[model samples]
Target: MTFKELKHFLGEINVKVDDLYAEKLFNECDTSHSKTLEGSEIEEFYKRLTYRNEIEVIYSKYASSKGKMSVEDLGNFLRMEQREDVGLNEAVALIQKYELDEAAKEKKLMSRDGFLMYLQSSDGLVLNPTHTLVYQDMSQPLNHYFISSSHNTYLMEDQLKGPSSTEAYVRALTKGCRCVELDCWDGPNGDPVIYHGYTLTSKILFKDVIRTVKEYAFKNSEYPVVLSLETHCSMDQQKVMAHHMKTILGSMLLTAPLGGKMPTHFPSPEQLKGKILVKGKKLQSREHSMTSPESLQGEEEESVSEEDEAADLPEEKGMPKKSKLKLARELSDLVVFCKSVHFPGFETARETQAFYEMSSFGESKAFKLAQESANRFVIHNTRQLSRTYPRGTRTDSSNYNPVDLWNAGCQIVALNFQTSDKSMDLNQGKFQQNGFSGYILKPRFMRDGQTQFNPTSIMQGEWLTPKKLHVMIISGQQLPKVNKNKNNSIVDPLVRIEISGVPRDVCSAETEHIEDNGFNPSWNKNFQFDICVPELALVRFVVEDHDTASRNDFVAQYTLPFMSLQNGYRHVPLLTKEGNPIASSSIFVHIMVVDQ
Candidate 1:
């Protein structure tokens, strides 16, 4: 094949080869001295280009002189390195399942290629397979779990000029997001619309969003979906909003108390499965009937929290004086469990707050609260739910670090899922714990109402075993080009390893850059980290181009919980900036964790 064909073939495999790697492969494959690859020569070039000698080292450790691993050898390797105590029968099954050579399978032996294939299979992945399902105790109170949530679920981009669509709801729900925010306002002709209240973002119809939410509510998770409504509508439109939800969601809507009365504790995700819950203000419990229009016609919502006031905009804060809006009787009746309420001081909350009532906090306020009264905040979360969202100043839809809030036991740390960063990466890694039901049970100390665990306490490593993590950056295979427009631009690739968790454990280290080898760049550098909190830690591996003239550009990244990492040779599948998996790009690494 010609050079152009070779480039196209690389594209097919999701490998972006620069002039340096391409030139070397072309020269090596031009055995006929024709300066181009023929039929068999093209195939030969591919085999040599993708082959990594690292696999041979691993295979040699367990294989015989004939480059084959017998059933006994495979079983021993699985039992010792992979930490699986499988018998010889299971080893033979794996050989028959992954080995392409029929003769090797009949002999109950795995070839070198088959060994590598088994290593790349799902069984060989770093994350435990049981974690990919709902494997946690789902019967606990809702406040006992960290829930996946999305803020500004309608905006696909910045709050100022982004387009709002029902597709955003679909995206968030499909990603196992249990709670979604909807900013509702009065639209033309007695209809309600959803968008950023005072921004240039285009509007999506409220009914369309409700329909979309109903369709995808249980698509990814069986847990409840909370519609956090920021209501700014007339009484008539409020009733219209209620009508739309009732008609579209039908019985899936949680319209009444689950068993005729609210529990002292919030309902569990298991109890609320296949249900859609509305989270909004309800009229004060009255001597008069609650369903009567007279009780609700002029009844105003509770004062707008600081986070929801008009001042809570990227460009506009402390500029508006509005506080309350009228609540319709029909709309007020829909709020069953998650009653939106103002948060007074912790003293007042612990003394008077109901289990069904919840509060929302801006990022700054939540972080400050967690800093000043972390133990109290954690104690509060044990009984009632609290949500933390990005501050108003984030005009670009950036995310704040969620680990601090999580450490304080905040249940719903809402983030812009569209803005992929270290924060969102940690969010994804955390939820992978409970089978992606969007609910991960908090640690026992964080769950106990009378707990003595102070997350902000200076006494580090007291309640848990401190661990030392040793990571060896082996190499990268077929990393994508940083600058796609420059076809011939050769990249100097490097790896940055990050540990994200509590304040004391958050740090990063990077490897030296390879001069110009996006393909098969080897580092063989090891990094050591002292982890203070192993349960909450997430390990992120980022690959980037080392650009001296300007800021380094991103190449790919893989993030997972530190506990999920396998200790032996493993391939970390690389993902794009938006957190989508790239086809064939990956980084190779070996991980070892031990008690410090």
Candidate 2:
């Protein structure tokens, strides 16, 4: 493709690039300093953008007219791609172990459906066979689970200058993110728009976002979705957002309680299936009905204290008093499930009579609460939902660790999904085990009436284990081709097992690197790690290409919850840079949970 065409293509995918950056990219691709990329250079460019290896797998899968591959054919494909000759016996055994097809065991033929299922499972990436509706107790209240949530779900990239698109909402929802944030402001044509305020992030229409949510909210899982609205629009513009939501979401929107009487307890996920709940500030009168007169007085006193604090600030001293923004009653009524509120201290919050009331706190404030008055915060989260978001300084759209907050029974631990960092890894690890339904039932000890569990107390005398994790790095199949110089193009692949969590920093072990192989390479080497806190531990398997002169490049990786990890022989699916599963690419392993 021409340089101009390449720029246009990038634009179509919402990748904004200026002329100078485009020229630099073109020069890099054209390694010979040629005007355009050609041959190997062109192929390299396409491989970085798209799944070239995955497409090759699909090609090999359908190479035969029968839409199936024999054991020999499968082995040949693996060897050809990974540049390692895999034996037919081992290939047939894998097919049998994965239960690729009941007929495959007898006929030795792997069907297309079986191949697709293997890819979707991420080569045993999922802990269980099925990955939906995994709650042990469906009757448990909604607040009794650690919910998968996203912060600033509209921005596709960084906090500042990122392109805001409805695609972000779809991506988050499809990944079982139960809670999504929408920062709404007045836009052209009087319609509400979603974007990060006082930033260079592009705008996307609010109505378009609602439509995307309506289509994808319940597509992956039939659980309720909490739409956390950060409204900064005028009352008139807020009504437009309300109208757009009601019109677009239709019957899926939950605008009132299930019954006429107020909920004595929060509803369960089972009860709110296929529902979209708006979460924002409700009208004062509606809030007044829930709180007693004494509680209301206490809230007023707290508000006065906040105003006094704000008055002391130099910025506030010279600023004019802005008029109070009023929330439209129609929009306010939609906040039936999670009504967002400013968190008062734990003392005042305990006595409040509000039902289904929710509050959000910055990461720093949440940490302070968990540290100074951990028990009070614990008691508050038991009955009511709480959301924790990243602090304002995370300009790169980074995320905080949600595990510590989950230990405190905070239901909505929102993280920046745009940045696929350690925080997102933890979010994926926690949710991937429980069917990816966006809700995992909190531990019994963390429930509303239960006071036995304290996150601060890690030295529980009752439960102790010094078990060790023994893993056999068996082999890799159909590994992706390395995009590098032909002289050193063949990667020396190795498997690294990382045990991440508590007592100290992350502990890891690696296998000996196999030379001149990206495919069916074997180590058969044993590595072990002593488990200090099994309940809080996570295991991640990473396949990296060993380099002599430069940094080792990542090939594929999978992280899983240690408690739910399957024992014995298993296949781990590899993921691409885009976080999508690489078809027909996996690492074989043998795992054993043993005593220290």
* Best-matching candidate per lDDT: 1
What TM-score does candidate 1 get on C-alpha atoms? 0.92
Location of the lowest summed lDDT over 10 successive residues in candidate 1: 285-294
Lowest lDDT 10-residue stretch of candidate 2: 301-310
TM-score of every candidate relative to the true structure = 0.92, 0.73
Model 2, 205-303: lDDT tens per residue?
999999899889988888899998888777789889889988899889988778745678888889999999898877665555443435344332111
Residue 294, model 2: lDDT of 50
Give all candidates' CA lDDT scores.
Answer: 0.83, 0.72
TM-score leader? 1
lDDT tens string, model 1, 139-237?
998899999999999989887789888988888888789999999989998899999877789998999999999888998888999999889887889
* Candidate 1, lDDT over the whole model: 0.83
Clashing pairs in 1: none
